[model samples]
Target: MQDLRTVLSSDTIIIGDGAIGTMLQSRGLVAGTMPEAWNSERPEDMLAVHRAYLEAGANYLTTNTFGANRIRMREGGLGSDVAGTVERAVALARQVAEGQAWVAGSVGPTGRLMQPLGDLSLAEAEDVYAEQIEALIAAGVDLIVVETHHDVEEAGAAVRMARQLGNLPVFASFAFNPRGRTMMGLKAADAAVAMEALGVSAVGANCGDGPEAVAKALEQMHGATDLPLLARSNAGIPQLGKDAVTLWDIEAAAMAQHAQRFVSLGARIVGGCCGTGPSHVAAIRAALL
Candidate 1:
């Protein structure tokens, strides 16, 4: 119930909620369909996911608006009402949180790359994130989490926009590959320092290969900056299961052990990514306790 900044400054190890896309998939959501659309069409499912995490003892519940930017919404047939859609997603999380947890507005990368590598310009990138972040703030989210970004500049764009929009805190999290680098080949230490320079509330790695790779990245990041760090790794590399169901390599107990390791490595906040659920969060809560 304390402000996120105050909680972070204290000795409490904050536990953030786990994956939304993967959890929705398990609840009969078809792959490749816009999950954010469920914000209206299937509010019960969204509420269930939020409730599960809150009951599992998550200090933060990240809203289900990761790909809610204008470009992705229009491309995915969800139209261009970015503000309305984002407000709806935040409402879903708030209904479940009920003042017991902080709702973090989730902003992910646009599927395109910036100039020299791709056509999207920096100004355009800022504009794209500006729209989504503005909606999140208007909807009264506690903070903005620009997560799962591979491009540092793109993440910085989100952070810059969020800072300009309001006083709400912003956390920038990047996704890393097994070699401890982003898809764009940025090392963890460099990404941490870059995001720190942008004045993010926290810099972290998420949805990477798994806990081992994430822990390694956090280790490098801890050495580079004095800012608070977060770690939200995937359960593990996903695998195909019977009936075409997706599965991950690491189990809940394994994830719990890594949760402890993340804190030991200087992550002030910890949680799961793809292939995690309430059980994983519950296990993390137990371990952290």
Candidate 2:
């Protein structure tokens, strides 16, 4: 498999596969459905989602195992199939990517907070991350991304686990609200520098806020470290109405323009997160050209 750095270096890599929960909901998955469980029950649909992104000009697709950690799986009644679910997620992505796109194993933060601030200790955090990383590596993921992190300490622990397990390139990304800060109040530059010191292959912002905010965060992250950058912002700020969250296409396009600026600011990987589907990725592809 081509390493993520090699694939990204060829051109600005356009990552796809986001809004897993929403997409599944659109397909009749209930409010509390375990999207990851679809790996065992509805593998074809998962593969179809991956193919859509690939066809939309995405150079990379993350597996649908973001919340597949043991802790979350138990809540979803999938605790027994954690490794199998992760392997299936990777296999399905590879099936769709074929020779076109690279598959990145998606590792979201464990729901618990780390020590000195919460009950979980550093050692416990390491063990949880190790389980996820081992499954991704065994499934032959081209790369691993630890994303949607809110706590700096937890993010650092996850990256450290990745390094100890293997040399596969690891990218660390955090979610930031529009206020220019993460849920834990860590600045973008602080997250970037900390992840860089831990030897992450890339670091940047993702999921929360619009592209403009993410672009500004990228600017803050610049010069914090020499590592490559990754940016995956939402299509727009979502609004809740009539029991649904809605985003506008025009807003997403405007965000794409900011994504172009992110590329200019030196982000090697760019894509959309929540509220961003194939259309958002297509816009990014158009912008790249």
The deviation in Å at residue 6 for candidate 2 is 3.0
**Which digits, one per residue and each the tens of the lDDT, describe model 2 over residues 98-163?**
878878888898787777778888888888888988998999888788998999888888899888
RMSD of each: 0.8, 2.0
lDDT of 1: 0.92
Off by over 4 Å in 2: 7-15, 243-252
Against the hidden reference, what TM-scores do the models get? 0.98, 0.92
> Which of the numbered candidates is closest to the native, going by highest TM-score?
1
- Best by the lDDT measure: 1
